[model samples]
Target: MLRNRLTRISAALCTLAACITFTACTATSEAQRQATASKPPATDCTAWVGADRNAMLPGYLLPRAQGTTGNAKGPTVCVPLLLTANQPPESYAGGDYHISEFTADKLKARWRDCKAEAACFQRVNAQIQRWLPPNKARATRSTGTVDPSGRIDPEGQVDLRKIRRPAFFAKAPYREGIAEAEGRTYTVEFTVPPDAFERIDLKKTAPIKLRGWYLEGTGVDDGKGGKVRALALMAPGGGGQLTAIQHPDEVTLRTDAKTGKTESLKFPNATTETMGQRWWRENLHALNQAGFDVLAYDRRGEGLSGGFSDTNTLEQGEDVFRVLGQLENGRGLRMLTPSGDVLEGNAAAGRLLAGMKANEIPLVLGGYSRGSMSTAWAMTSNYVASCTFDLPEVTCAAPRGLRNIRGAILLSSFASGAGYVGDAPDLADRNLFLGGMAADHHILFYPTSETLAGMHRWPAAFFGKGLWDRAESLEGTVAAYNRIRGVKEIVLARGPHSIETWPESDRRYLRERMVAYAKTVVVGGRTVPGLPRERMWKDFKGLVATTPDSWEPSSRPRTMEKATEQ
Candidate 1:
């Protein structure tokens, strides 16, 4: 039965895939030439220490960003709530905040008198909450000091010993589950930076500390063909051990073939292809604080990954695929499913093909702006399950793959046209589009950006050849989305093009829908949690009325929504 269902899903998805001619969708003839061109080997072994002795800084967390749990118990470890550093002002819940490093000694000594885990930590958690903005921007930083050798100075390590009992839960399921693979009872590794860790000084009140670090083992699969994982130690500052942090997330170093120079790639950083990678790296320290095993790299033509020639979405996909291939190459951080479960990349692919796949943990494909659309296109294969598309679909066919996709988290999906009759007749049926004359349906419209310089328009650098750069009828896409048989284009509240533009409630709501639906469709069939129907009317009005000037619709509408419904 499961196999049958998956087969059906694949068939439906393939229907979209098949619409394209072999020549149209086929990879560039340069695949062989590019394949032979040995990418500069990735650099290895550049380590960094978080302000907190034992923890690793600059790591990202999994499970989309969530807000703090007020009235909570235990130490409040400040984890990054957002993914990118250039997040919109609205991404934060709304509060005055600043960055500072806290030592383990401070945390341990603060809550020295608390006996019960709950009471002791609750006081401190509240204090930390006060420090953050209501809808806080997820803190990511690339501004830390670099050593003379150009490697990240691994000095700011989070100490674990002083971590008091009862760690606070920022997001749901805060308690670390039993280490499925293997490890100790008190798995204390990968804590946040001291600056990120804060405790409220409540006199005569028991203080709070993080609930020790969890051991995220090594050699996990990267969802393609290899394994990637990290092991590190984090602790509180105390006992003359100011610099006693050991083993941070593995810093990979490979010599550039062309440059013939060694480069260091942090496992917990985002793949630097464009400015987005820079934003991701800046937050690794913040993400590490939040208990995420972020594995980032430099894709082709960007950062350490070489062989980039005027990069496009397809080339970017191959670059990302290589990272997975690297992880599966038996080297780095592995990809997990929506449920926090790990899988061998090869096995995962095989299972996907066999239709015996399960979503134990979230294997998130996070793309910022342009990358988001690329991620969506990449998932048309068996590689990824959940993707976060940040910009509007530049091309029409990109959105067609949504039907069989396990999760589609569109930060800003593009579909601003009169209707679905522009270019690319092939995409007409794939996108869940509505007719030009249809009544106002609950369409998934992306909001225009109020921040970022080029936030409103598609970047010209991305036009390689395919539909991405080509003009397609948004009308067709809108029609496809409306009629497509899958999750609706669930719109979050008015977040600008960046997910950061929307309020945390709005972003959280969207994430909840994505995660929940991911769990059901990808993991096991189950209902996802949050969907704000009440806000639909307001959201709808806001969407249709606000036409983003950034999106230059195809000239001479083959199809467009009628200005006046009549």
Candidate 2:
């Protein structure tokens, strides 16, 4: 039924203006089909990917995430939850499978048995909603006050004249991977005075200490625990539960960059016990159980750290750099004990970061949504990340190094360009995703490098996103996949904007794929069953109209020109 509604991406790409109203991968025009050919389905991209009900993960993964809800449960646990340098929708919608396809025998039958097209659509939609946990509705990004395109004014602001933005950089992925390595880290460095409530600035290059929880697992308890640790965070949860907790050195004071006024904003700071969101808590535990010590924290400005939040990828990448520096610098991080009544001053240094350099542990640079943008930023580059928003043209070339970063995991990546708006955007149900679609962040591929060394970071990667992700378009993610030139695997499933929002089945699947990936590239010396080993992805074009992602680009087109035509 969906196949009839879907058209090839080749035609969709040719029709630029209409593509915005819907997703790019699933066009609906019969005439457009004749214009061009769609890229190969995802099945052709790699051999490991099977139906949505199948697993592309290691069999040995059995984690016990102590405190989580939904699919993130148990020791044999169900499941849960990418890469960088940069960062999709559907021309190829309509996956034949569902996360619950095989599990719910009756529900699957009901969906499959109904012969009436319209009646079945209604029946399946209603039943699907009833079977899953209710989705928790979160507030969307404010369309007012701040326009990503920077087009309209706040409409209510008192003055726009006096305010200034000394620090700003073009969204990095748009440039593909040019001088992104050298651009401003887009992060601010400062110190919190125990007495004074305000923060003091040093420079951008200096490392900013971030507050997070670290658990050792790669080795036999090192008298304390293990040395080899891994890092994996949540989808773009803006701040931690301690969102109300302000950074001790918050110089920005949560002010609006445009009007120079205070805004009621908070960071995902740390508490004595909890280091991340529910999803974070679960994934952290999973990695620890998987034999890789896990280190996660409140990102700068988002939690109990200094500076402000820009939600930029390079900035987040720099944040990763700073935290890694603190871990390896021998300064010894202040750790809170498992008991709320804690201890401090590297008491677990032997277990966490004792006599060894932190870089020795191959870590995966990652994030979701805006977080994925930081993937490329974590790579080897001549340019140290610097953001001149506050102080114009300030260089932050501090001694930042994490040479052993083996891979990246980008979840629901950024669209390299402003993709399709809507087939009929004026309608209420029309998808109006912004952010990744922000014209300023509308990056495209122009980089000429096709070698692993030329990439900003190492090339081993696992890129995954949702077919239902409204924040990013399918075309945009392909652009991101195209930017990276190395061994990479791309996975598309039907879920929510963030992994936390996904159901247990989908979430469990994500965990399996993630653990498989972490074990292989981040920890090294292991190849799990069903692990993806594709070299690169081919470009795809289409106007998506809502369907599960079931296809992938072929490894190569028939000819060289066919590969580059789109």
Candidate 3:
């Protein structure tokens, strides 16, 4: 009705204004407006274009400016949410709100105290209202440290140890039937299950190895042919000590729908773990099953791997360079557990190499959380500092760029912004989104800025995150997905920040999807189902409202509902 009324109004205005003019007015106006959205006053549409390109600071969770019609100083032009995502915001119920009145040091100490035994820790979390925190932005945090418990004191403090004992029903699950994968997202890795992957196929051989300081997973069909197809190396989450992918058979128990009790029901396989073992067993299996020989290594100083290391950004990236280079050369990360108690897993599989040269193989690399950051930066800092690095999609992932790389898989990826897209104080007047929950989603351990600028350097990429993830922001991941200039796939499924927290079915599908994405781009050299790809972001001074033929649509501003937590 509004569009029809506008059409009639435009016709009336054209007719009324035609009496005083000699040429077609509305036609000229229509021609001047390049965007499909409502027309703005400027014939050039400069305000709309400018706002669209730079003003949508979604990282801050503030609303785009919606212009008013009668302002004497000209309209405060708006920019619609431009990036598209795989799912809508409603896929997740508003996450649970749990308060942590202490610091991470204090909280992690509690997990360590509990031995990570489900029953023991269940005792510790009695007073906590839920399994996860909303990660909302703080109005007045003394420090910027974001925990899963965004419910913080002024000093950026959260103490889970303080809330111990008593009632069984005080706390609710993030969702019944769904269990957290990494447990608290913020929970310390007090326990890690090694030998995490079980052999899914015996016909084609892949091996698990215990080299000196490295734990490795690698293999291909023995002498079966064609360059082992591809090799994908995945790293674990930075915070957890999880060494490898979880096996598919392992289960996570879910609470009964009627009651929020953990042990209420009789179903044994209540839920299959999404992430952090079979270390993400299914993802590892999917890639391997798709003919991509797989490798997963523990970062030095953490997991079972030896050697002292810090959480420095480039250090992890350097690890990739070492691991990938080693695999390419068919070298192991030192091999074996002192010759006796077992020549197990990959080592047990015997002579793991496929007898193919490095050039014959295509390389794909990735990881869970901070691990993904390592891969992204490694690709960035390797070379081509001044060039666009926009290789064609065919040669993009493989047969091109640094190290004949095929692609990257960034699960729980970094989307956009530096600090937080969560709520801020005194800024309620601005359109705030998701109540700033998950503001601490994948909170930064270091101070580097957003990595979106360098993501174009990546080849065929697959980005996945949960709908109600407390680990990373959904909007930011979508931003990363939309911004990548090459073949990319975004899988936003129903779950929390922890993939392991997702239902078993969703986990299985995602694992399969990862490999399928890899196979499509890695071997066949094609893009998968995805949103429109974009190249230029920061400095497009050209007529953005008119660039119609490219992957990016014309930037047109549109009105937005008042974004508030009603």
Candidate 4:
């Protein structure tokens, strides 16, 4: 009956397709006939298990020879779970082999019958026991935190006070054999599991420190002797302390740029912890090695930085300006701690910034995700203030607005008014910001695949009021900024929404391009070998041409008009 029902369904489908074209009709009809005829008729006691049923069973439940030697064997009896009922017969069984053909309902009935058979049930249950552990014996209790340091006692106990935050490490897999000699490292703090916090007797302590190392030849060996070497080594504290800037609202953790070991000071609030430290270190290390100063601080209401929580605001831009000013000239800089102690500015930062200014070193501003948005706004605010009230001539509005900025690097960032209408002011600010940028100023865009995917949906749901095409949206954005001067836009083939998720190749590509662009455009240094063309607009155009499906048609010009009107 089941087979007959399937046959009827197949016939109806073939007949419907037959109306579309004679050739498809004949071919489909013949294929359906062949499939139906080949299927054995269902038996009275058993039903047919089709391809769909076979796929439903978990793969690990399939019966197989026991032991790694493959010498062990099992009973020759065919278990219904392991049988491929839809396929051609591999062996002959009692009476008619057609009895194995069972539909879902019939299969369940047969399983009940098998369960009733004492001998068969015992055999099957025994086999099942080997594959699955008994429920009562399964592990369920939490074991607390497992120390990655391997310093715990034999019984899995440890001195919690000695625990420290872990260090992170990362290496470029794309440069596995070539650049495996070196690796990057950074400090890391781990979140404690909720269950661990529930332990009554366990005392909660400050984050412990662990040192991480990324050594060559540490990754999985690929039989070919070339390993994707990447290792993270974290050890307990060695008495090192981070400098803190105490403000009325918050205390900002500061790492001196003059240390030379410091890369970029990441704003903690801008991105989530999902952007792993290893990835952050890799990119920052590359820039640091190229003789660039990197500084990171927790923005207001994030990490150690104190203040109200807000994102991409003019106030945040002001905070950036203040930080830069502090770095440039530490004179009159002071931070008041909760204990009423006044902290003076670091002379090292003042000297570093002064030297750069004296030498006429151009600054490169870079940021990821919301940080990029913040950076863009900051630059815009500075540029807008510098221009004369009604003219293009420069006039100082603030003491530090990143004068002599050579380039901007934006990664995984969207336009100001990306998802909401409230961002219109910011969007307008960006338009003016782009107009203020010099024609020779370089801007590098590193949008991930995830970013493109998100932008593809922007016009339909969020930006419906405007005319937008995926390609046109991106290209027009750069063109709006007159990026024709010097622009490099590299779309990473694979990565999560965060630029920190970029693979080794993408990271290397970005580092090389950034260094090369800075060398040629900023510092007037020698051009690095193997760098892509100075401008990526042409390559981007080629990508759009070859992958037309990736881009959507632009909406009407009314969209832009609507945006401007807002």
Alpha-carbon local distance difference test for all models:
0.25, 0.35, 0.36, 0.29
Which candidate's lDDT is highest? 3
Clashes of 4: 28
Residue range 372-480, candidate 2, lDDT tens digits: 5555444422122222111222223322335566667767664232222111122111111121111112211111011111132345666677543444445445444
Could you give candidate 3's per-residue lDDT for residues 135-198 as a string of tens digits? Answer: 1111111111211221223111223222111121123421211121112111110111111111
TM-score of each: 0.32, 0.45, 0.44, 0.37
Arranged by TM-score with the best first, the candidates are 2, 3, 4, 1
Candidate 2 at residue 373, lDDT?
A: 52
418: Cα error in model 4, Å: 4.1
Error of 3 at 417 (Å): 5.7
Worst 10 residues of 3 by lDDT: 94-103
Q: Candidate 3: misplaced stretches above 4 Å?
A: 1-228, 239-275, 308-310, 327-333, 337-360, 383-403, 415-447, 529-566
lDDT of 1 by residue, 40-68 (tens): 12221111211111111221111112222
Q: Count the backbone clashes (under 3 Å) in each candidate.
A: 113, 66, 35, 28
Off by over 4 Å in 2: 1-209, 219-236, 240-276, 303-313, 330-332, 339-351, 380-401, 415-457, 523-528, 531-566
Candidate no. 2 TM-score: 0.45
